[model samples]
Target: MTRCRAWLYTIICFALAGLVTGCWDGVELQRRAVVLMMAIDPAPDHPDWVVVSVQIARPQRAQPPSTGGSGSTSGGNKEDRPIAVVSREGRDVAEALQTIQLAINRVLFFGHLQALVIHEQVARRGLAAVLNPVAQSRVVRRQIWMFVSRERAEQVVNALPVLDVIPGMHFTNLFRNQIILRRQYDATIGGFRQRLVTPGVEPYLLGIDGMDPRLSAPRIVGLAVFADDRLVGWLPGDDYVGWALADSQFPRLDLTIPCPHGHGQFVVNVTRVRSRLRVMNPDAPRPKAVLHVHVHGMIEGGPCVQKEREADIQVLSRQVQQVLAKIIGQSIQKAQHLGTDVFGIGRQVYRMHPSAWHGDAAWRQTFPRLRVIVQVTTRLDYMQTYRQSALLYVDHEG
Candidate 1:
């Protein structure tokens, strides 16, 4: 009976295999519309209408870009490459997207879309209209990073060598590395919206500008500053770092400070960092915040004073603390002067003093005038030395 059952099962397995075949319903790469990146900007000569740039992968011509190289690789003459650039006009974002569909040959799909860049002109108008379509689209991935371009979206798309085929993939990788390395601004679309619509905190996007129009590919120059949904201005990369650190997004920082004793300058590499936010007098006429930051770091390279004693460590730690304190103060003052709350202090206030926030017009007026006390504590944990020692001086002859 066992032998008969085994033979019968074998026969059934073969019959099932004969009836089934893999990929019977799969769509081939050539048949589907593969989108790479998207760029949206205000239409030329008309603020009401907008232009959309769509980049698609050309799999037949080249392999995907290797780990570290320029994104666009030319498979053929620049103009002859089979890519789509569609411009559509509509009062609303959905209408414009639909119009783009009609303009393109293949059905437009955005599941693989890499980045969504907004032009400064449209971002300045406000992002409510722009975000409506993104939120409703099932094809749009939530993780797609967003940026604000100082140049028109059309220019950013067209000014490419069409190298890697998937421009969005390249752009996303660039921003992701910056975020992980804690070097650039943190303004992903999801995070930006969270900060923008979450009651009090506003949002800002990285302001991008083309490096050289004549070059084959363009690069970013600066970051865009926003107040709520309006584009306020642009901040250079270095100034933007301070804001990133204050926002708790920058995990590691290596800053150089000029020390007269060190001839050149001292390079401090921050190894460990902790920050605490305190709300003081939440219900009072004036609200205060204490940004208590404790950082542990070591001097990587600089002029040596030839001392490695406890007293020397104390003096070095105090000096580094003072430098960090001044930098944080300047950054906070600059953001306040611009009337931008990139730090989300407003949300902090709402969380701590819910009752006081009710019908509080004064908070809005006072937000630009709020006070922040920044305290920096630096500790030098290690020194590349054998024994605890002080500076050695040669004996003088009488």
Candidate 2:
């Protein structure tokens, strides 16, 4: 009978322990400030100090509607604004974050951080100091999108989103669309981290600029090139598209080439672009790198040359190949002139010929002098819905 009583007591103790431990350390959702994005800028007053702006989602409060003879309703009315921007300054990013936490009643949570924006000044000065803390943080995720703002990072973060209820999500959707459209490079904290440590590759981020003085919205403008951690320069406008082609990230591109008949320009919609890089004479003092790009495309709104003959297609294809080669060559020259290896050609050499790569310094010295060749082949497979140009049909009928 004593043994049975002891067993019952043990069972009760186990149940009590389980009940006591459940949610013992979990904080209530209301007590947490969910951070959606963070922006880092160099403090204007003090050069050494950094300004950190955090965008937190504020929970909406619903008010009950009031019903009366006057027909006034108050229920379900609430402020639609979803985010609050807060800023703090300190000697470093961590200290700035600590100061920000002191101002908020709830604990700041970074697990939901969607974007990280660095001001142009901060990036120009160097990102190592600002990014080091984020890299070390346990709550921050590496997959968050990273962008360099042409204006103050705070302004970019605080801008009201036109499409998304949350400002951070606006930036997220922009990047998503950019990837789908193949308009710019898709940069993330994880990708940056990998490139930063890689021996031969340099890091780059998508550049974003405010549309107006008030920063009603932010738009991606170009690519920011980084040597080590410092912003070296930018690849603006169509120049970045060429870089994208070399990087093999270009999904589709539209180009205008001179018509074979020399009357006007025609549109070529390039798709299925494939790029390959080859390094030759790895042991040589000056090595050669060749980039070969194969593109399959169709003529979408172009005048027909040579009565739609097969020779006309070859001529058009050759013209497209020449244009692509020129663009890719120009991009490579620009990178070489800037002394930045945005193409990761050095990385290719390092992978193919590890013994040739002495160090970063050596690679940098050899990169500018390395000979690069760009070869582009374009195949015109499909013409538009009409077998011949509409103009041609009219001319034949006439």
Candidate 3:
């Protein structure tokens, strides 16, 4: 799978290299506006109209060294900005995009597009109007990241970031780091499309809100759940982390556990994971599923675990295991309540028990009532070398 993906990316890069290097027809490269990011929202007034926005890479002119004489500052700070944002509304997504192209001077080029942001409300309405075009169009790469915005997506595409000067750079960077550092994956348009069409599984998108005025990469709110193409519900904030732990493979996550005895908390960076989710007794009525996760982690912080003893380490591992189990349980309960199978449990059921597993509608009813059991085991590593917390001088309680 890994090699196939690598080859697939290589072929795409090789194929699209020409689009970026040269001009389109007779138009100069400088005259074309490279759209770095795009956002879609339901029209403010029109019940069925769509609002689309694009962030174009601002072209900078060569500036001569100021000999303290030339004061050609007509454009003010606008010339120094890295991107430009344009928005327009139309009856549909493709129409809105065409209207935006007419509104801007330069031809709108989407070959270089990096990210797509869809307002949560618009997502709930349905994404076929948006995603259908994206799928058939040869220009936009299916690898672009997709986000469901908690706030108006226009703000996400317009606001510049302090660190990433370029719009959507933060998310692109985070996507790379998520795979490399965290050993996890974020939703890509290609993956989402597959999920959308494949039965027995539902699609989910990473959630964001560009609440910050300065436009740091959008804040991660949670996950936007979907039943087919329309959004069903959300898993607000850290509530999604539990789902992440169960669904993703071998992710290096920082989990904070309360001090076993006292008033402080400790953080553990878990890695080197051995995990799997199995459909136990798929033939039985109301089939049972077991999620077994084993992770080895090292103490990363806090005043707990000051000493390196076998007994103490064992107890600490148990505590971490309990917390992980609780989190997994909560995530499972939330997913079941929403009646959207984000965990791919239904897919597994179909694979194992094809006869018993019916179509999506039948599985949907069974999923909510399905019995799921979570088992987590944690092992603490580097206990001997872990840094001991500083001793605080506590006066005798009066």
Candidate 4:
């Protein structure tokens, strides 16, 4: 009985201690600040000075002490709260950020940041200075999306969207959708850094600019190509489509194949795409790359020609394959001639033959002289709608 009573007493004492001190690390929501986006641009007066723009979430409008009626709407007043662009002049990015601290009320928090928008002028100068903070911060995740804006980062971030109140949130979702659906190249900061570190692989970032918000259209205007840590050039608009198709990372793509025999056009959305690259060295000859692409897709739309005939399907498939082969081959040639390794062919070669990597010259020296061959094969599956016959007859002459 004495032992049982001592055990009960110990349990009661522990329960009381737990109730007294439960959570010491907890923080009130009002004490914390959230950042939406950040932008870096060049200062006009001082050529080396940097301008920093930070978008912070505003607190909900407080209610009156008596009635307790809130002033904010159910959806939150995201648009009314204009992001304050605080411009500071300093010799370097670190000093600029420190200087801004004096002008702002809350601490500059970066946990919830969506993107880091850098201006065109700044990108040309180089990103090593400004990017130092992001790379060093333990709180900042490496996957944060980065972009080069043609307009001033301030204007790009402040542009109000007609559909969504907060432009930053909308822009983040838009770019993310491009990767989820495989519409454009994957340009995450982490992946980009890896490519930059890897020998012979050039990194690329997409250029983002706002269109007329009334029409709800946002577009990728161009691409910002990088050689290691510096920006080299920009590839304009759909021209990057070829680069994307050539890259093994962006294999699945949508293409509209036009019929040469006046049968109109067919929209083909590739489902599974695989590319095999081989590097052959024949007795001191310059290394040659041969690429083989195998794909399967469904016919989105086209005029039915010999719809049920197996021979016709085979002919059409072969023709489509030929067209794809030509387009892809052209893209590869363009990248090689431009001296860009967007396809990572050099990296493949390094993996295949480690000895060749150490002995051969730099990728740029060999890229201009490298030769490439492309072969493609496409298989078409069942039509989107099954009601139609393989061959359709307009009129039967009996």
lDDT scores in order: 0.64, 0.75, 0.74, 0.64
89-135 per-residue lDDT for model 2 (tens digits):
99999999999999999999888899899988888888877888787
Whole-structure CA lDDT of model 2: 0.75
| Candidate 1 lDDT over residue span 1-398, tens digit each | 99999999999999999998888956666566677767787876776777766776555644442332554444445444545556667776787878877776667667787677788888878887688787567767666777788777776555444344455554566556555234232466666666666765667776677645333444565456667777776656555655555566556667686664556677777766666677677666666777766666667767743467766665566666666666666666666677676666777778877876653344546666677877676666546732222221111110
Model 4, 290-367: lDDT tens digits are 777666676665774436466656666766776666666665566666666767777876788666774223776676
Show model 2 residue runs off by greater than 4 Å. 1-25, 61-80, 180-186, 212-215, 258-263, 303-307, 384-398
lDDT against true structure, model 1? 0.64
Q: For candidate 4, what's the RMSD?
A: 8.7
Q: What's the lDDT for residue 191 in model 4?
A: 65
Better of 3 and 4 by TM-score: 3
lDDT of model 1, residue 271: 66
Clashing pairs in 3: none
Least accurate 10 contiguous residues by lDDT in model 3: 389-398
Q: In candidate 2, residue 125 scores what lDDT?
A: 85
Comparing 2 with 3 on lDDT, the higher-scoring candidate is 2
On TM-score, the candidate that comes out on top is 2
